[model samples]
Target: MPGEQQNTSELTVEELLHDAAVDSTDIEVFLNALTRLAVHNLSHPGEELLCGITLLRQKKASTVASSSDRAQKLDEIQYDYADGPCLKAAREQVLVHVPDLQEDARWPEYRETVLEEGVRSILGVPIAIGSGNAAGLNLYSDEKGRFDEEAVESAQQYARQASRALSLAVRLARHRDTEADLQAALESRTTVALAIGIIMGQNRCSHEEAFDLLKSASSSRNIKLRELAADLVASADPSSAGAHFDR
Candidate 1:
């Protein structure tokens, strides 16, 4: 009963991500915070010197979203050589911690290549979103056996924060796109209305006839209706009665 109760209390990474309840501002803060945490955590004596975050696309695990040269190079190494902890963790959706590269033979090519770069240890943790595949947070250390279980757990917590932030960002981006489209539509309609009014005054025509005139002018001049409307508005003058019919 006690074991089952403890298991029930333990929350999965997905649950933790939802608990964060990310907003647009929170998304920015979360990303900045995660990067800061990674920097600080790696700054710990003997911890891996993190290059940057490398996001593994769910549709293609080999594809990576790396912001820097170092991270891109690391992703290339993992993909080309095929034996790094980052690759393993992302593929398996689990933590891969290598205490020392000198003695670790799990990935011979990777070990040789990474050690040549002055890295002695690596700790990779999977970054998952929802119920899908995972990406990786690859941490490199100059010292042997740098990340312990506690450090890995801390990294996992940060990954959870990142997931929530990403979800919120995507949602906000869609909303912004929709809002922009709607505003553009409204502005276009206003321009058309203004043009119609201008044509009515100038041609001494009905509203329907004015709109038809505006459309004919637009089609003849090969100008956007909105631009034509704006031009008509610019030509009209309030003080001169002839200004309305001038154009």
Candidate 2:
């Protein structure tokens, strides 16, 4: 879009996504479709497309794309070192790219790292998450002067799609984790409650006092209340008496 003339392309991205299945397994399909479009620009005169999204981890960079290994490594280095384009993009929620890493001294550490890896140019675009933190995409090139203004615009268009895909993936994963946690918490609470009840009967104490006793025992002995409950349940009868439970 920025470097190439806008009148030429035939297929719109919406049409492509509409055609492709928008499921977990089909995400790669979307990525492939977008990249194919960018590749087309690259082949024609004055056009190039390099795009990629980071994996959905760390909460900060879920759907963003990068052009090369150099760019990804730059992101990791930024994460570890606490400085770089990825951090800037995440913080600002904007698109960023360096057409010539050697020429830009804004981030010397990143520049040096990519230079060492033989990368000359790079781009990063934010993946949105309905007004929240999402992943980012980075595009890189081995040759300098590969990404001009028009190319960056095309990459940005593709990045929008990547962002949506990333958001879907991350939210789904988070939901699954939340559901699992809720289930486990419910079961654990049942165990703890049962154990508390057993302690109340054994000690002839009220519910509040039973809870206090359990807390005191757990703290002093440094054993988890859940495990203590399980042991109490497992032992049953008189055999449970004075069973030394190590923390």
Instruction: Indicate which candidate wins on TM-score.
Output: 2
Cα lDDT, all candidates: 0.65, 0.62
Off by over 4 Å in 1: 1-30, 41-48, 51-145, 206-208, 230-236, 240-247
Model 2, 1-247: lDDT tens per residue?
A: 7335443342354445444424534455444554455455443455444445554344544333344444345556666656566556655668878878889988787678768877788776666755355555566677787778877776677667545555665566567678889999998889889877777767777888888877778888788988877777666565454332222
At residue 84, give the lDDT of candidate 1. Answer: 72
Q: Which stretches of candidate 2 lie over 4 Å from their true place?
A: 1-72, 200-213, 237-247
lDDT per residue (tens digit) for residues 43-96 in model 1: 576543664444454446553343345655766787787557887877777888
Model 2 lowest lDDT segment of ten: 238-247
| Cα shift from native, residue 59, model 2 (Å) | 8.4
Q: Candidate 2 local accuracy as lDDT? A: 0.62
